[model samples]
Target: MSGITTSFFLIFAGAAVVASLALYTRQPLIIAYIVLGAVIGPYGVEWVTDLKLLADIADVGILFLLFLLGLDMQPRALIDTIQKSTVVALLSSLAFASLGIGIAFLFGFTLVECLVIGAAMMFSSTIIGIKLLPTTVLHHKHTGELMIGLLLLQDLIAIFVLLLLMAFGLGEFSIMDFSLTLLSLPLFVAAAFAAVRWIVLPLLRRFDRFHEYIFLVALGWCLGLAEAGHALGLSAEIGAFLAGISLATSPISQYIAVNLKPLRDFFLILFFFSLGARFDLGLIGEVLVPAMVLATTMLGLKPVIFRYLLHGLSERNSLAWDLGFRLGQVSEFSLLIAYMAAGSAIIGREASHLIQATTIITFVVSSYIIILNYPTPIAISDKLRRD
Candidate 1:
């Protein structure tokens, strides 16, 4: 059996077990996924070997994730997302990044290492936030809207950083190159959007009559555009997202989503499992103090910064607190940032591993915290409002 095939079986078996446990305990299944990964990983009973193919599939998972996010977005929503959440995301990200870098500096990490650590800490996991959101609440409340907005902001920031990293070479950064790269974003997006509308849409519309054809067309558009984006020095995630958005108005969008769910789930499991198995516990051990320091800062300080941002926007303290508590954990994109930075050699393996470890720890802890306290926080807000 192929290594990737074995890994998929293991992940599927793990997910099934976690699903049962999550149902029994009334907890999120995502936590179960992480815990399962840890249990069957290199640190545990060694089962799977080949990770390269799984890693590649995980990349597809990321593309689908971005695509789904875009599918949920509407053009009219951008103004509101930016106005409500842009400043909040930015301020929160800056505060977390600063705290992360400061802790790294205090722990005697190099300047480059500190920079990478800080940058990695700036993003929060849109995937978790979106997946965990109550669909009922999302369709009803201001808080849900704010959460969605915040996630969109974080996604944009992550994409920009990815673009920057891709544009830069092995040597030090260049102002001219950076300027050119930034200028190219809108052009690339515009061109992609235009091509999708004028060319891709017609072909997809015809193919929509056949279920197999619809699925193939959707996948082809996503992958084809992703490849085109890579060729043009943009992240494939960007193209995949745009592809989803382009198809959002089509009647076949829902069909595509339904068809893609199993594939997405399968690959996403690989993505998360690979994330866990690839972690360098040795480096984490070496940088134990720094890792702990950074984790503490994220857990302690991020919420406070977000609370302040919310309060500044005239939100009630209690509501701000709920929002803060919900967003306190570092995002999944933080891992992606670390992975990219490590791959690019912008930071050492230890620094990247430290960030990833902190992220996983924070994600597990924060998910529990929010799940437990969500109702209490909302109730407290209502009490405060009445008072």
Candidate 2:
């Protein structure tokens, strides 16, 4: 118990000092958290060596993030965003996948490795996309709607990819397994709404005046649905999203969203820290050249592709470019795909290492670019700091 407490204390205290230094150096606090993680993680000082525990800690933050996204999405806006972005997301994802496939092929990866790497490239980091987004932008702008729609759609696709990969890895790709995967999502959605309408709303009404109770109930609802999603073979993030969207029509939705920010940020710091902590610097030698090429292409091309597609669809130039820059990074899903593929022996250690190294590179470099040049909640410059 004391050991756990001490480790957390170190994490937090280290975060504070690093964050202060980041501010002094005009760097994003995100860089600070990640750097602190690498320094204290098993790869460095070995203070926190439990990757499983780190992932669990990270996932909670991401769940809250998706939940908060749902909270802000009014039904009409969400529907419109989905309608507008479906084509854009599909096309953009295809382009990204092709880039990965081409790169992997050129580097002499096997067919399976090429395919898996391509699959991983089809997503942008949801946490990076939304966390850096200014609240004012998200609440008031069309850009927000499109980015949200794209990120969510990409996430759904990423989940499906994992499911397919899982079945492939187990060599049990039956019709029944496929059917269950397809059927589970809508059923879970329906169940979530029904529970919210029938059970959650009533409880909230009964305890309308009790702020503390409302808070507790909100957490319970989110975590409960998340667990249920996992049990149903979906995902906790998806479930948390459903939990938030189900309550979107409620009067207290914004109140809940507002109150959850602090706790969400608390977990998010750990999430970013864990990202750094888990990075294997030893892979740098084996994967450096490919990782650099991959990261550079993603950072340079993603924005261009997104911009052209959006512009072709008649979006404003500024908005198109902004959205492009905001979303032009590899996803957390990419790392997961590589991990799963490697564990399943679908890819070799070299391929997995390349994917991991590329992802970390893009994360750090892309973050620096965004913070230095664009408007974000944690931008280094006063002019760029939308917060």
Candidate 3:
């Protein structure tokens, strides 16, 4: 218990100090959190060695993040965005996946390793993309809609990739298993919608007057659906996202979304911290060359590919370029896939390290580029910063 207390103290205290310094230095606060994790984590000063506990808690950040995203958009808008962005998302995913596969093969990795790495490369960082976008821009701008739609589509693909990895992990990668897995997704989505329509929405309608109760119920509903997803062999993230989408039509959705931002940030800080803490710094040297090559390639290629794809879809050149830059990074999901694959012995440590190092590098570099060249909430220049 004391250890847990000490860990929390270190995390918050470190975050406060580092975040302040980041603000002063015009750096992304997210980098501060990750650096804090690496500095005090087991491999560093060994101040917070309980990596599993931190990781479990940190996952809630992603859940709430998705939940808020759903609340922000109406169901119709979400559907429209998905419909419009599907082609761009699919094309960009294929391009990035091929790049990853080719690079991994060039480095002498096995076919399975190449495939896993390729799948991991198909996503952009939703957290970074959304968190930095101003709320006003997100709600009113076409760029935001495109970014959100593309990210959501990518997230769906990531879920399927994760499921495939899980099936492989369990040694059940048969044709029947794959078909059943695909079938379960639609069934689970149907069940989620049905429950929301019949039960959850009614409860919310009846209890709307009670603010505290509304908050509690909303939280419970989110977590409950997340657990249900896990039970049904889906990720908790997908479940939480569906929970938010189900509530998007309700009048109280805005209130819930607003109140939950602080909570979401809290968990996200922990998530980033755990991400850094879990990384084995010793393995970095072994994968440094490949990681640099991969990171540089991704940073260069993603923007060009996305810009061309969005332009082909009739988006304005300026908007397409901005959207491309915003998404020009490997995702946190990439790290999750690498972690799971390595843990399951599906990929070697070197492959895992390559993914981790490249992700971190891209994250850092992408943040700098976006803040410097585009409008973000945390831009250094007053002219570029938007509320």
Candidate 4:
């Protein structure tokens, strides 16, 4: 009857369909959700007219997803990964951004538009990459570790860039703003670290025996840290990540991850599907050429540059190449950054649409590639090592 009610049913039905497809096809569930959204959304048959409601709800899913990701991360592991991943992530981002900007410039896009496009190209799809990597590969191989490492680095970089943009747009770029942001960064980290170390860890130890308590406590830890981070002018995603790192060393980390996974799946499904529903099909006709050009550059050139960068640092070729592929797609961060840019009037609605469309395209295509290659890579790695 109402928009919300109609949206609820559609989301429910769409999620089921996507879930079934994901289970049957062994494809990433996110792609299924996006496909369902595109088919059923306003641009399609108009089966769901209240995509705005769903997008708001999907924000909760994103918050929860980030929270869970935080729970899964370990501080020592993150630091180690960053130290190892810096060279690859840094060089790859620079190279990809340069290529993306050059491509956009060739298309007669403005400097700011090129900057946004460049930023978009610098990141890979965290959701798709994580979802597609095999569990065994994730834990057992140097390639998987490197992929994970670079992704973590990208997340941090994305959050900071968002922060910088916000600070600049808010006209808060004084020495005080810099000092505050800089000081806030480490303080947030230390606060999360301390909370998990002294408070959450003890609570977890006490509650580990009770699955329900463990679950609730994990949720609280995530939201609480996110709220705290928001209060301190940092991104909630960064806070959630720190929260994950804080509890990363806990004995119950694995248990927490396992128990919370279903919740993660439920929320993330809403997220990806909502993304599909928000598509502005009209802009595609106007910006499709640039979007495709940017997408192609990111999907093609990003991995190549990343592999060379890592190899230059003396990393193994297979690991470098694999990590490169894993990190090639434009990230959802690009969408978030474009939103910020739009608010600043630096990028218009058309530019934002271009970014979102290209992001979704890259996300779907890249996930498909990863899923198809995942098993083959494992088998080939074993054979080559033995040979």
Candidate 5:
């Protein structure tokens, strides 16, 4: 009875109870998912220790999330925003990475540890950023366009950084391989759009009334290209995003987005829960002081840096500040980098755990600040809940 089936029961059942309590206490349900995971996870109650399965599914959630975002994108707008936001993304990432390196060095971490730690800090949480964005603002506003552009650029940079980390991990870096990976983006984009025109649109047009068929095709198209992207040395998220964009001009794109929402949410819960479940609270003491220092500094500093940077580019003070607060957290990519670094022996477990703890702290604190002060999909205040 306590096999995988029971684990599912525990996860969903516990989530329901905790989420209800969070609502009653005027807290975000995201916190409830994390708390439930920690309480029921291996390090706490010693349940659901085999996390590999759930983690795999969690990746799918992210793939679908990016795909959905691409589906909503107006390609021309995305291009213009990308051009405007590229400098912001690069400069802001450089600032955050420098801060991470300085903090890690001051804490007496080794040179390698400091570099890896700083590399991890160069992005923000895609899930958190996109999830919190109110749909009213997201699909229509200039701020939304700019935010998406900046995030996408950071994602590309994260992928490049990850490739270098992989090269370091293997003790063999290849210039040609790196060059090819960079070149693959446009080739893949062209291939995706071609497929949509030659294959997907025709099928959907022919079987427009068969809702189930459209669903299956959309899912297949997303995952199929995700795998394709991975084969081409690009990230699966990028591939899935391209797949979504290929269909963006279709009349059925909105229908596909609406239908996929529930499925996306179901998997996203597992993604957040898996985060809490994987964190070892017992080992946190080793990294606690540094984690607290890093987290607090990042929370206070990220918004200020972003606000000034965006404002310097001619964004209004209010808009720049809002974007800044919204992005003022360490990224999910930080956790991924920590994992990869530890796995590759580029950083020790202690350093990896430091990254995890710092990220979790930022996730929790940054979210509270955003929901309290801004309009979001899950704001505690009725007036602020714009979704």
Candidate 6:
């Protein structure tokens, strides 16, 4: 077998064994994936050293994940969700950003580092929040709508932040440049909706009887729109999401969603693995103290802040608390932002390491808390485990 093929075999085989052990021990399976990556990664046993290939493949997982989320949401329903959750999302993000800025300053980070870290902290993990949510709740309950809405809003914020950072990286940061980039968002949205309404939807309706063809077209459309978005200076993720949203009202959307899940999971494992494999264990020690402090603070404050915001928005206390805990973690976007900022030399290595370590730490701890206390697909108790 080729080296990459051998690495894939090692990764999947290792993942399967570790996943079983995680289930047996009543731990979140995601933790197993990360641990698997670390053990066999270049820094560990050197079983897999092709980090670039894995990272590139892993990005598809994020695209599919966003696409599926868009598939689940109807345009009207999404609008309603945004209306209800907008205030909460914005306020909570500001609060989180403030917290991050304060911590970075306390640690004596540079102004640029503090600002970038602060922006990174403003998001919660869409993957963790949605993956752990039971389908019953997701499909039939208000909780899912609320969670999805807030997450969508945060994603928009994350995208804008990434664009700004990109501009900063290219040394082209300016008010006019930022304004023009922001303008491209609505323009893309308009163009995507028009294309879907006139072209994609008609084709789907015409070919509705052919399952295989329908699946192929859906995949093509998702990636095509994603590429177009990137060409227009937008993120592929935002483009793919809009692609899903455009088709959300179609009768065939649910069918597409159900079938795409297995494919999405395949990429997601690679995403988490790449995330783990990229971590340099040796560098972690240098930022250990600040990372721990930042992680602990976010974990403690997120739930409290979310609960307050949701309750003020007239959500029931119980429901607000549940939503709060579900979203109480640093996001995968945080890591992405940290990676981008560090690569651009906008943030120091220690600052970047702090974001990464804190994000992983929160992922593990938050998964444990949510699984134990809420109904999830992998909850330890049968009563709490709902698909």
What do the candidate models score in CA lDDT, each in turn? 0.73, 0.88, 0.89, 0.74, 0.91, 0.90
Candidate 4, residue 230: how far the Cα is off, in Å: 2.5
How many pairs of residues collide in each model? 3, 0, 0, 2, 0, 0
TM-score, every prediction: 0.86, 0.97, 0.96, 0.89, 0.99, 0.97
What would the per-residue lDDT of candidate 1 be over residues 36-122, giving only the tens digit for each residue?
766777755667556566678788987887676565555466457568777888888788778888888987779988877888888
- Overlapping backbone residue pairs in candidate 5 total 0
* Model 4 TM-score on a 0 to 1 scale: 0.89
Q: List, residue by residue over 56-138, the lDDT tens digit for candidate 3.
A: 99999999998888777777887898899999999999999999999999999999999999988999999889988888888
Off by over 4 Å in 2: none
What are the per-residue Cα lDDT tens digits for candidate 6 across 224-293? 9889877777788888899899888888999999999999999999988988888888898898998989
Supply candidate 5's per-residue lDDT for 60. Answer: 95
> Measured by C-alpha RMSD in angstroms, how accurate is candidate 3?
1.4
Higher-scoring candidate on lDDT, 3 or 6: 6
lDDT of the structure predicted as candidate 4: 0.74
**Residue range 1-387, candidate 2, lDDT tens digits:** 676687788889999999999888887788789889889898898988876786788789988988888888886788788888988899999999999999999999999999998888889999888888888998778888888889888988888888888889997788797779769898888888899889999999999899999999999999998899878778788889888888999999999999999999999998888888887777678889988999899999999999999999899998899889888999988988998999999999999988888887788887888887789988877888896
How should the candidates be ordered by lDDT, best one leading? Answer: 5, 6, 3, 2, 4, 1
| TM-score (C-alpha) between model 5 and the true structure | 0.99
- Residues forming the 10-long window of minimal summed lDDT in candidate 2: 1-10
Question: By the lDDT metric, which is better: model 2 or model 6?
Answer: 6
What candidate 1 gets wrong by more than 4 Å, as runs, is 25-27, 137-145, 163-169, 315-319, 375-387
Ranking according to TM-score, highest score first = 5, 6, 2, 3, 4, 1
Which residue pairs collide, candidate 2?
Answer: none
